[model samples]
Target: MSKNNSPDSIIRDITREFNTIVDSVSEESNFIHDRYFRFAFADPIRMAELLTLFSRRNASLKAFLDTIDLSSLRGARENHSTDKHIGSADLVFEVDLKNGGTTGLYVGIIAEHKSDKDKLVLNQISEYYHHLFLERKKDVPVIAFIVYNGEKDWNPLTETHFADYPEFYHDIGYPFKAIYLDVGHAIDDSEMKSLSPITLVALTAMKYICAKAQYTAPRSYRQVHLPLRLSA
Candidate 1:
């Protein structure tokens, strides 16, 4: 458990780390974010919190997430053979079926974290989704998510190569839902105090872009901008 629980500082640290790595390192920043994101999200607790928040918008998935055992998040891996590695983490789990009584199987929930620079690789992701179904026998629910954390960028769905020829892959429906969780938008000032300690600390490590100060100061003193999500 980390000592720092402040969301503001955490958010700042995330942006700083990402920007620093991209600016200084020889390697493209994708691998760095992939490793960092995997470690942070692999922690069942943090993953649960965000999923809980996401469940607010979805009813069926909400029910599934309620009893989900975070201990089952296997690990993350990226296929680096391609020139631009569109890294994705693997989250597999199986829970008791709400509909099926005793014969229920363990359902797999594969979540792919899409960062700022990541393009939409529908073919690759779709292929991976199929592999999970065929290669590994698992009841993959409709709850798989493609978490898009990039604020300003192209949409992963329409911007991909598949856009050119929809006729070829019209039958195969995309398995995962595109859930946007961009950190570019700061939390409202009024809602900051009410945030959970875990959420505050975890979100920074989750996904966030470095933003400019939104406020200005008075004449005599220098402008001091407080963090958007104040730690209570």
Candidate 2:
């Protein structure tokens, strides 16, 4: 397979189907709510569930990447030490090829997901990228993505745009691509039909969270922190 962007048709169908399933699942689980879902440090279980969902999506993403020639597709690894704040992003992931004992192969990605408001994950991704830089000993091509399940449109207020956030000041040696995976966008009828189960779960969580976040306590970015361990 070649490394091509997902076909527009595929993207649309996947998004559409996913939205349908989420609506169905939410109804069955009685997961529908109107309050904003807060991703505080106190809610570790939700964080773990979110991480597991993301890892599952990463598998799908890898398959999508394979269609475009990306090799050595692998699973996700949560970097507990690299959480955005203390409880904001559930976890950061490192997805890469099977390590071949090479010093600088530059094949992995660093990612974060949020189900809460009040946290600037774009800035957080920047911080995590730096952490990876120090740990990996190389910029190593990094792809950063955020699965945001917020209700209202969260136009990023930072100097960071989704396409350029983590890569804003990154060197050419360490290329990065940032994308915002909006759950709302996933359920839009025009785009939800082809979404995989993993993406559907992400959107469902987003729907529930966004519904809950509206009335929750305001979360300060500085105090945001990811959990130390992922839930089972």
Candidate 3:
């Protein structure tokens, strides 16, 4: 498919229904800063790459990433259901633990997304965590992976954001936090010669929230780019 920037145009849904649907795609950038984010990281391979990216940035996460049984990943889920009601997660990941004991047996990554500086909902993430726990009736370890695509002054939610102490707080030796993605840094380094092409693609997509307006597939600068331009 040609790279185009018609946010109004309806793109084909690749999975589920596979029938060309309209208005179901993430096009508008108002209510939600990121519309196409789910599409980008929904794949487990891409998700693994993202986690690997995290490991590269934060050394502590490397150990956590190592514990994840990526081969045992069941796949990514969206809008996962609870026993009584529905609570949607931007992306949900299920993976087994590698030689995990006690709380590390089976794990889940509840990836909540953001493009603006929205704080974590009071109990939304925890609620999902509890729901997943009840379903299995086991001590399931879960990670709240918050992928913030906004370039503005954004940070992880503080302990005050929760009604009570989070389950994983003391276990992880910190307030409940997210596996964060700094989108701006990704875009800035996207042009680096040292990075891989796939990394550039991931970086570019990560910037969709911050630079979506200026991001266009430019064959050139303009008709008067001191000597270059892109024409249809």
Count backbone overlaps in model 2: 35
Q: Encode model 1's per-residue lDDT on 124-219: one tens digit a residue.
A: 566666775655654455346555544455455554444457677644557754444443343333443445543543354333332222322222
Q: Local error of candidate 1 at 230, Å?
A: 8.6
lDDT of 3 at 2: 17
The per-prediction tally of clashing pairs is 1, 35, 0
lDDT of 2 by residue, 150-205 (tens): 56666443334444647765433324566555654344433323444333333444
Candidate 1 vs candidate 2: which has greater TM-score?
1
lDDT computed for candidate 1: 0.47
Residue-wise C-alpha lDDT for candidate 3, range 57-150, written one tens digit per residue: 6665687778777766654444434421223666677888776455646776777766666654425666666665545564556777766766
List residue ranges in candidate 3 displaced over 4 A: 1-35, 76-87, 99-104, 135-138, 158-177, 186-202, 212-232
Task: Go through the candidates in order and give each one's C-alpha lDDT.
Answer: 0.47, 0.42, 0.51
Model 2 Cα shift for residue 80 (angstroms): 6.7
Query: Clash pairs of candidate 3?
Result: none
TM-score, candidate number 3: 0.60
**TM-score winner:** 3
TM-scores for all candidates: the values are 0.57, 0.42, 0.60
